[model samples]
Target: MPLLKVVYLSNNTKLYLWKITEDFDMLFSQVKLKDSSLARLESMKSESHQKGFLAVRMLLQHNDYSDFDLFYDEFGKPHLKPQGCSIKDVEISISHSNDFSAIAISDSKVGLDFERLKEKTLRIAPRYMDVSHLKNLSEQEKIKKATVVWGIKESIFKIKNEEGISFLNHIFEEDFSFEDKKATAKLIFNNKEEKFQIQFDSVEDYIFVCAFEDVK
Candidate 1:
């Protein structure tokens, strides 16, 4: 599928999602990749991973950018090179899980995470999340909510991209109702506190979460 959905997460930020229904060859043929990206793609052992990588490029092309414009930092965070001396840099975040690939672009720093629905997320909820939040939900609801919480932590971690930021110990998600589709979290690490605004939703058995650094 081409560009499954576009989410306007905020006035300055937008999320683009791609459902990876195309075959590897089809996706590979569609996007023009930088030599480094081609080398990295050749290094990937799994077809699924390669496809996810290509689909991200496809999304970039959908938005008028290409792989040549994207790069990574020493911390492994993705960054966009300014198109020209006149164009300002935009914050970008990318994630892929199962059959979906997603990217978020914003004027401010942003983080995005995509997770497939699975029993493991619920089983391991106690390890990283407050299991108390799962108490009143059914088995399926537990899975969905736990997956969201996991994405919340992952999204925040992507934004901070700092060493020793343990999801269980440092990232704290506040109480939120499933119906709200939004929440808040705090990163209490290294004796510094930072706040983030969280937004999440489910898409075809997958969960998409986005975190934006709170402006005070």
Candidate 2:
């Protein structure tokens, strides 16, 4: 399916999502770039926006001819162009599967992540997830909830822009049920507890999880 239309996360936040098909080459050939300037992907750190840009423009065959370009601020954040896009202070994120590319833009400093569930991820769960977040997991069912638990914490850390937070030390989930199609995460960021709701959709090989800021 084509990427979902951008949604309103809040007055200042917009969300965009996409699902890529296995025929990626066919998909890439579809972007409507008659001619333009844009760097190749070998340089950028893995981001969904890059792939989604080509995929979305290919699907739209945009007439605006707005080329995609990204720059990084000193603190290390990607800046998007076309100034007329959406939110001005928008923080963006992208995630993709072997076949899918999803992107979301938000009003606050935000982070998002995507992971293909593999035995390795399962094996490393305890290393990245907080014990408190998994307290609700029954010993038997914990195995099944493994990915759900890991995704939430990883996403939180991504949003915080930090790596050594020790999921066991800081990641915590309040009242949430990943099985119910959504869950709530309450983790400490910058020593401040910022809580948010995470929604998920289960696909063939990977799970897509999103972390959002509270909007007034």
Candidate 3:
């Protein structure tokens, strides 16, 4: 499968998704990886993790990019080098869960997260989010909502890429209904408060979330 979906969140930001249906060898042979990435791939202990990594490369190739053009910072945030003569820097975020891999490219700082819907996430919701938000929801809805909240905090953390930002302590998501398919959240850390615009939806049994820093 090429791309599960392509979403244009704005004129400058786009999201690419891939459903991991191919086996490890199929994905590995479809894209080329740099030496560092190859070594990292070999070091991975799980086949699922390797498949997710290669699926991301597949998404990159779909956008006319290769692994050579991608690099990671010391904090392990993925970034794309200036493509050709373009002077504008492109920001990118990558995430994958059990059955999906997703990448978000934006003209501004962005973060992405993909999580599978499961009771385990909801079971520990109190550790990372406000359980009160889950009140009055059916069991199935609770699982979905909790997973989205987890993704929200994760996406926000990916954007900040700063230390000591605890999901339970610093990140807070405003109450949002599943029907809205969008919401807002805030990060309160180091005496600084920053807001983010959240856009999310469920794909199959998984939830994908993208976070953009609210500059306004």
Candidate 4:
């Protein structure tokens, strides 16, 4: 399928989702990949991974960019080359799971993470998040909320893109209602603490979360 949905997280930030329904050959034919990307694609052991990689390129092209405009930093975070003389610097974060790939672009620092709801996430919740938040929730609701918390931590890590940040020891998500679809979190690391604004929602059995540095 084509671009599944476009979500405007804020005035300057937008999230794009692509549902993967096309075959590897079809997807591969739709986008132009840099030689290095092609090599990386060829090295992928799973066809699903190859399709997800190509789908992200497809998303870049949808926004008037191509593989050529993308690069990664030493920390392995994806970055988009400056579009031109535009004054606004664009930052991006990417995530793909099972059958959907997502990208978030913003004028300021941002992070994005997508995850399919799974029972295992709830079972492993104590290792990474505050299990107290799961109190009073039904089993299914627990799974969904746990997945959101997982995405929240992953998203924040993507923004910091730093080494030695532990989700369990360093990241803390504020308690939130599943209906609210949004929350706040804090990262305490390296003798300092930083805050982030979080937005999340359920999308066809998956939870996508975005985090922005709290400038206030």
Steric overlap count per candidate: 0, 4, 0, 0
CA RMSD per model (angstroms): 1.1, 5.0, 0.9, 0.9
Using TM-score as the measure, name the better of candidate 1 and candidate 4. 4
Q: What TM-score would each prediction reach against the true structure?
A: 0.97, 0.66, 0.97, 0.98
For 1-216, candidate 3 gives per-residue lDDT tens digits of: 779999898899999999989999999999999899999999999999999999999999999999998988899898998888889768999998887899999889999998988999999998999999999999999999999999999999999989898999999999999999999999999999999999999888889899999989
Question: Where does model 2 exceed 4 Å of error?
Answer: 1-17, 22-40, 43-70, 82-87, 130-144
lDDT (10s digit) by residue, model 1, range 1-216: 889999999898999999999999999989998799999999999999999999999999998899998989899999887765648787999999878899999989999999999999998887898889888889999999999999999999999999998888999999888789999999999899999999999898999999989998
User: Which 10 successive residues of model 3 have the least lDDT summed?
Assistant: 81-90
Among the numbered candidates, top lDDT falls to 4
Q: Give the C-alpha lDDT of model 2.
A: 0.58
Could you give the candidate ranking by TM-score, starting with the highest? 4, 3, 1, 2
Give the alpha carbon lDDT tens digit for every residue of 1-216 in model 2: 665445454575554555654254565566534333245543446545456546545423322322343344565555454346554634666555555555555556566665666666656767866445456666534543567777777667667656557676777766455568677777775677777677665565666667765443
User: Compared to the true structure, candidate 4 yields what TM-score?
Assistant: 0.98
Residue 6 alpha-carbon offset, candidate 4, angstroms: 0.4
- In order, what lDDT does every prediction score? 0.92, 0.58, 0.93, 0.94
Q: What is the number of residue pairs that collide in model 2?
A: 4
lDDT over C-alpha atoms for residue 5 of model 2? 47
